[model samples]
Every structure is written in C-alpha cells, then in structure tokens.
Target: MRDDMDKVIVERPRRGGSWQGDGRAWRNSKEAGSHLGMKRGYHRTKWLNENLAPLKRWLHKQVHRPWDKVYAELCSGIDRRSTVQAHIFEHIDDFVERGAVMRDGQVWVSASWWGRGGRAPLEEASHVELFVHPLTGILLPNRRLREARAAQRTRHGTWAERRGDKPCAVYHVIDENTQWHRVDGCWFEVTLAKFPERVDAAKREEKRYDVLRRCMVTHGGAGRRPAPDMPTHASLYGRNDVYAANKRQLGRREVRARLGDDA
Candidate 1:
C-alpha cells in the first residue's frame, strides 16, 4: 500500500523547479503541502482507492458465489464480527435477489399455525416462500407471510377486546423450541391458550405497594416528584442499568446476608 502512495500526483508547485525525479524529493517539497494537512489527506485517499477499494470489491465478488460454497470457503472459518461476515449479512438481500443464496422451498406460515405443521392445505391458502440469510441463517419472510402476520395481529386484538381485556401491548417469548406471544395480559402458545394459572398465581403474590407504584408511574406520574430511587419506565422496560440496581434492592436484606456470608 505504501509503495502505491508514490503514484499519486501531488498539487504542482507554483514556483518552477527542475524535476528531481524521486518520490521522496517530491513529497518533501513545500508544494506537496504540509504533511499534517492536505498532503496526509491526499495520501490516505489515494491509498484507500488504490488498495482498500479493490480488495473490498474482490471480497464482494467472492460473497456472490453460492452461499454454501462461500460459507464453506470463507464465512465458516471467520469470526461473526469480521468484515467479511459483516459484509455478507449487510448485503443479504442482494445475494437473495441475485440467486446466489439457497432456497429451502419452504413456505412461511403464521406462528399461530406453525406448531400444527402448517395452515389449511387449501389451494388458495396464504403461504409464501421463505428465504434464508446464508451467513446468519435468519429466515426472511415473503409478502404473503407478512400479510398473514398482520391479519393475525388484527384478529388477536379484536379477540382480546371482545373478552373484556385491555390490550396494553404485545410481548414475545422465544425459546429453543417455541415462540410464545402474550397480548392483553394473556399468554398464547402456538395459538391462543387460556391465561395460565401459573401467571395468576405469580400476579397474586405481587406486593400491593409495588403494584401501586407501577400504576402511578405508568399513568401520569411524571408531573409528581419521583421517589428518590425510582427507576423510570424506560429503564424498567429496557432492563438497563437503573433496572438492574432496582432489582438488586428488591431483596436487599437477602443480598446483604449472602454478601456477609461470602465475606
């Protein structure tokens, strides 16, 4: 790369001088501009264009090969955060569009119908082919699958309201085998299930003061002065540092006792 730097033509000197015909002499001249300023900028841009750009272009070409071949030859051996891996994931759609990625020939079905093998086998049933991101192995859904998911949301919301439950928010719980959806305080596995008895038991055990505090904070409590150590709703929901500290204080006596024993 440094050897290529000599090839860049610097801004010509205003004062005429005989050609030294040497890279170092040209670089050292005042008209090449100060090393700290335009000279450094010129060298950096030239080196990048001459060396880095071509290398990146070559890497992209390598990525355009069939995913399995590319993975076996390149991605599998590299760290997930490596530039090559990042490039593959960032341009995943490009690979799919170009037919460089493999298609499993599987259609994406609604999560509600996923555990049932698939939705109804009718000829007009809504199902769309699923595409896989070769490098990250993430499934990308097609238009019909996306529409099905939207329709499912509408159905769930209507059902919850009809059952007299306040539709607060949607939450997802993903595990190795399944993804559970929770809406309006009801948990559904695969499809809508009865609100679990275990959740009711847990809710019954919640402290009255804690429940009251949450209610106040969530419902226009911002105008009032907050408790000295109260965590904001954003922190609580985000499970950030403030939430971690609040959690530590939840069973402070137990924690202190454990720490004393360790000491």
Candidate 2:
C-alpha cells in the first residue's frame, strides 16, 4: 500500500496546463518553491489525505466491503469539514472511473456540492457508477440505510416509538430502579429508588384509588369522597370526549335496568 501510494505521488503531473485544472496547480506553479507555496501544498495535502487517501485504497481493490467497515476506516480521524467534503466530491469521479460502487446501502451522490447550488452535469451519465454522499462523504449504495439510520437515531434520542395505531413515549428500563426518559428533547437518567418519598407517595396514591373505588361501590356510587376529591368531569373536553358522558359503564345501574327482562 505504501509503495503504491508513493508511486502515485511520484507519478503526479509535475508541470503542465493539465496541472492548472487539478488540485496540484498551486503546488507546481512558478511560486511553488516559495515558503507560501510550500505551506499551501502542505495544508492541502494534509487535509486532503486525512479523508481521501483511505478512500482511494478502499476502492483500489474494487472488492465489496461492508458499509460500516468502509465507514469506520474512512471516517476514523476525519473531523469532516465542508472544504474537505467538497474536495472529496470533486475527486469522486476519479474513483468512479476505478469501478467503485457501494456493495451495500445507498449513496446520495449529487452534482451539487454540499447541497449548495452548483453546476450539474448536462446529463446524469457520470453518476451511473459511484458517487460520494455530500453530507457524510461516505459512499452508500442507496438512501434507505442512511434514512433508516437517521430515524433510528431520532427514535433513540427521543424515546418515542410506534405502538399499535399511535406514537407513544417509551421508557427503557435498565433495572428495577433505573430507566431512561426523554424530557424536552433530551434523554435523562431517572433513578426511582433514590426517591423513597416519591415511591411511598405513589404507593399511597394507588391505595387511595383502590380505597376510593371500594367506597364508591359500597356507597351506591355516591359519597363525600376522600380528601383529594376526584374531578366530577374532565376539566377540558377533547374532540373525542364531548359525547363521553353518555357512554355505558358496566359498573353503572343503567346496564342492569336495561337488562331487567333478561335477568
């Protein structure tokens, strides 16, 4: 690999009109021997190789590697900058010519660099092969894996999931006393065991509800109830609840009255 990379540097066009159009232009220009030129080339090579070199090696074989394997290799030390990402986009065609295509996952390669307006090809011929993703700079086979990964991250962060017919908040229980909760779009660690008072209060509140139900049952569904009185009706009516007052309850007398003949 080192020999191959060294050969590439040695074979780079030293001086020509062609160099003017490529990244080596400033490095090989008349001012190239000066301190400023050397500094310019040094920074460019450093930043460029920081991401591009491994990618070249990864594709040089044209053998299919897993998306994560490639991702881990290319992105290892990358602090991904817009400039570097753009540089990768510019060189993507060179790799495509080397017969590289994503073995798995989608690549969202676009003519537009970094999703900013730019000159796209007159036709989509060049993209029939491989393309680099603008945002992640990682080559994907399609958009499905990228979008799915994003959605998974969102669900994990928000503690939300689709259950039955509705979206519901999810609590990931780590243990009897510990769980994760999403609050205000951030995840928080909650330790139920640490709050003995809250645990006691919850138990007492549950007992109160049980006692209140028994009281309602014994007092023929009417009573001067417990200290914290239950609301007679919901304080606010939702669209679905406006007709709730007439709904039949098995515990109520109306069902028995209607069933007198059958009884």
Question: Which candidate achieves the best lDDT against the true structure?
Answer: 2
Among all windows of ten consecutive residues in candidate 2, which has the lowest summed lDDT?
236-245
TM-scores of the candidates are 0.20, 0.21
- Model 2 pairs whose backbones collide: 105-141, 105-142, 106-140, 106-141, 106-142, 107-140, 107-141, 107-142
Write candidate 2's Cα lDDT for 26-109 as tens digits: 766896665564345443232233335655655645334444455444444333364434344456455542222332353223
Model 2 score (lDDT):
0.36
Model 1, 1-263: lDDT tens per residue? Answer: 12222222122232423233435665677767554543342322321122233323434555324445644543444335644334334433332321213235433232322324433311112333333444555433343443454454555556647788544433333332222333233333322111122344334422112231233231223233355334453433332111111111124354335333321
Q: Clash pairs of candidate 1?
A: none
- Model 2 Cα displacement at 102 (Å)? 15
lDDT of 1: 0.35
Best by TM-score: 2
Q: Evaluate all candidate structures by whole-model CA lDDT and list the values in order.
A: 0.35, 0.36
